[model samples]
Target: MKKNIFLVLMGILSVVSHVCAQSLPQETSQSIGIIEFVLKNSKYEDTKCDIHSCQMKSKDGGVSLTLTHATMKQDKEEDLHYLLKINVQGTLFSTKVEVRYRNDPSKQTMKTGKRSDEVDSSYKTEHRVLRSWIQFIKDSTTSKS
Candidate 1:
């Protein structure tokens, strides 16, 4: 009798688990094609953009966008270059965005900093701002299309 009851309970548990799994909402996935199309049609104010391939398979063939901003120093007419790269990957049913920020100033201007080469430094607040900005760009571009 105990053996029969144990088998019955196991059967019920399996059925319930299957039902729950099927009822759970699945994440909406976007295709790489759509992502590429949206990126091509997107535009940013006061920024120059360069789009290229990142070649990450898991991210459904990654796409990279380098947004460069040049600001002129107040005292000197030197240009300070800031580059923020947004790496986008589309998986089977999800999209991922990674942001990389860097400061690329002229050798003369960069002398004031610790390193002469491009500096890769960003704060949490900056990341939040960039994430929102990227979201805006994505939304605006999709809406226009």
Candidate 2:
């Protein structure tokens, strides 16, 4: 009975906590600007992008947005409750994220695997903000002939 009760409480807590995280629109202009900046400044090898977009996959058949700073804010939302501040070492910058329990203030769960670089190896949860930027670049670019 004790074990069952403990598990039930933990489950309820998890749900409650998750319900509090926050998420913004996936295609916001602010997101696009950040993605463009990272892609242009990262020097990630053969990446071609302006302040507006990035190119398709490289000839090497791989894409990596290595961050060069430590925890840059990708969104302008003031109520950063569980904002996930991530810092990578390669694509663009290297930095840490300001996340609580691996969720944004509104607990936006990142389901995509496009830009999930963890600066620290001990982390298990991936940041979706980064991935969203990466996807934006890919989606905006025109295919080469």
TM-score for each of the candidates: 0.21, 0.21
Candidate 2 local Cα displacement, residue 35, angstroms: 17
lDDT comparing candidate 2 with the true structure: 0.38
Per-residue lDDT tens digits of candidate 1, residues 1-145?
9999999999999999986654311211122234445455544333322342111121223444543444445223434333334455445333443332333321111111132222122323223344444455545434544
C-alpha lDDT score of every prediction, in listed order:
0.38, 0.38
Q: Which regions of candidate 1 fall more than 4 Å away from where they truly are?
A: 1-122
- lDDT value, residue 97 of candidate 1: 38
Given candidate 2, what's the lDDT at residue 2?
100
Q: What is residue 29's positional error in candidate 1, in angstroms?
A: 34
Instruction: Report the C-alpha lDDT of model 2 over 1-145, residue by residue, as the tens digit.
Output: 9999999999999987775533234433244345446545543334455543334333333334322221225333332223323333345434332222232322333222243322222111223444454444455443321
In model 2, the runs with Cα more than 4 Å from the true position are 1-44, 56-59, 64-124, 128-145
RMSD of each: 17.9, 14.0
Q: How far out, in Å, is residue 96 in model 2?
A: 26
* Deviation in Å, model 1, residue 71 alpha carbon: 28
